[model samples]
Target: MTTSDILRAALVGRLTENGTLTDAAWAKAATAVPRELFAGSYFVPIEGSTPTGYRTVHPADPGWLEGVYTDQTLITQLDGRTSPEDAGEQSVTGAPSSSSTLPSLVLDMWQRLGADAGHRVLEVGTGTGYSTALGAHRLGDRNITSIEYDPLVAARAASALRAAGYAPRLLTGDGLDGDPEGGPFDRLIATCSVRYLPMAWLRQVEPGGRILVTLSGWSYANALALLDVTGPGEATGRFLPGYTSFMIARPHDRPPRPVLALLPGEERASRIDPAKLDTWTGSWVAQLAAPSAERMGSGGNQILSDVATGSQARTVPDAAGGWTVVQRGPLRLWDRVETAIEAWQGAGEPQQDAFGITVSAAGQRVWLGSADGPGWDLPV
Candidate 1:
């Protein structure tokens, strides 16, 4: 077999053995699509960099092919413009704007989506077209429609898909808006996270269709949900088991902020340990409690800055054994977080799956245990 074929087979074997590639159709599609085509060049982070730096890799480099086939997300663009070719030999630093998502996650989510024969699918965020190729392979090119926000990224993905001899309807527009004209699709999957389920997606999908997406916020905690559309402008589902995250959709990302000026207003002993915010479930709870605040720091040194009301909360380890929190502005950020965390603790500190979400004309609400339980309204 050719080198690409051999590598692809090995990847499929590893995924199947680990129980990630459960669907035979997905396995076949994984084997057929060449991932290296989409990841001709990528970036790897430079270890131990203070601000985080990345160096470029190319096909000519040793282990490039192996790295491409490995089940890991490969950074393809930085700051929306700098590609591997642009970085050259030096380390470059910027926020990751696009990537070829880890193969295992892609395959697993596709299987979890339960897409079957003749189902029309709308894919949000066609990053490198690798997942798009797999979907096209199994469901036919005519049945898939993928949308990308970055025009440059979309153009590159289109080239790669064409080279692989598969073409689905590709659009260079905001995935958050979705393809309205191509409406009533059986399934819609977002590769990016959103602060809330977009109304456009709800209206575009037919009743009884499924919408799979990750809900995230300023704090960056993510919860994956698969909602069954009960009717127009409405859907409900419980959080899926396991932790999953994706970059927040650009439109839903927090706006730029000025340098924070810490203000001290009310001070009190924290009801719960401040270190809890560092844990996965705890961080998610804190986020649900203060959806408009951006979280920073970790452990007892946590800081929260409210985007809307300019409210701020900061915690520090107190000499008296527990943690102390200082709050300022109209919003009592720490109080909201403490109450939420206490509620979560009262329920035995359950994982994300214990939570459920509902999206309706009334608004998006995330609840612990059930719909009537203690819940927080998502800042839509």
Candidate 2:
């Protein structure tokens, strides 16, 4: 066997051991699919220190090619363009337009879906059609419906799937609407992260059907929720232990506005000790959770906020061995942040891990540790 084959076996082993895939069908699908064919010229290298980062590798390099195929993610499209050719010289800024999700996560999501040979599945964000191919392999192409927002990507994935002998119905449209023509699906899986669950998805699935999606909010982490449609317009689920980051689907090609634009300017200010800003305040939490927010720091100087509005903020160490928050906001949002810190400290310096996400019939809530007890607040 080739090195790629060996890596593929290892990945399958991990997936089976992790309980992400159990059936012989899943193993056959994993082994049959040629992962490198879907992966573009480059793949995003997985880093130990960071969740994701990009590293360019030539297609001819056997080691890199095997690594890309076996380890999981393949950066199919950078930014909004499908391949480097379409992106021209501007590819660096495009972000990840399409990718083959990590194998373990893909199996985990598929396992959560509990799909069978007879089930009808609607997969959102058909980037590269690798997952669609896997589903088609398990359930057959006639039972799968895949949607991709980008026409270019949709066309390529359609062609790729057909070439692979799995001709699932492929649609190029906004997946948020959940292909009405293909109604009443047995399972709906969103490969992308969404700020809110689309009502159409909830309405389209049969009662008691499962809808698996990644819900991102104003928090540092995103939650993978497995919700069951209990009623006409209700679904409930809690945070899954793992986290993932996916491109935000937008109607237009342009990216969403920056988060900093929402904050008041630094000039409109009240003075406060920067050391007192609580990182756990609702606003900061909200900012961290914002989809537009991106990390802009290298170690200590790093900042996290929207790049468009230029709302930059960071934390630095002081002589006293404490951290100071340095922020530039129009209304001295930093001052409010300091007040929140004081409130938290006055109550008690809460340790980090005490935070937990609570989901109820009404909505989701985030709780923080406090001296008296756990303090809870609603997510906006």
> Pick by lDDT: which candidate is best?
1
How well is each residue in 98-153 modelled by candidate 2, as lDDT tens digits?
A: 87788777766887787887888899999888889899988998899999998988
lDDT of 1 by residue, 23-127 (tens): 899999999999999987899988999699998889999999999999999999998799999889989999898999999999998998888999999999999
RMSD of each: 0.9, 6.1
TM-score of 2: 0.71
User: TM-scores, in order shown?
Assistant: 0.98, 0.71
What's the count of clashing pairs in each model shown? 0, 10
lDDT of each: 0.93, 0.63
As a whole number from 0 to 100, the lDDT of residue 184 in candidate 2 is: 85
Error of 2 at 208 (Å): 0.4
The numbered model that scores best in TM-score is: 1
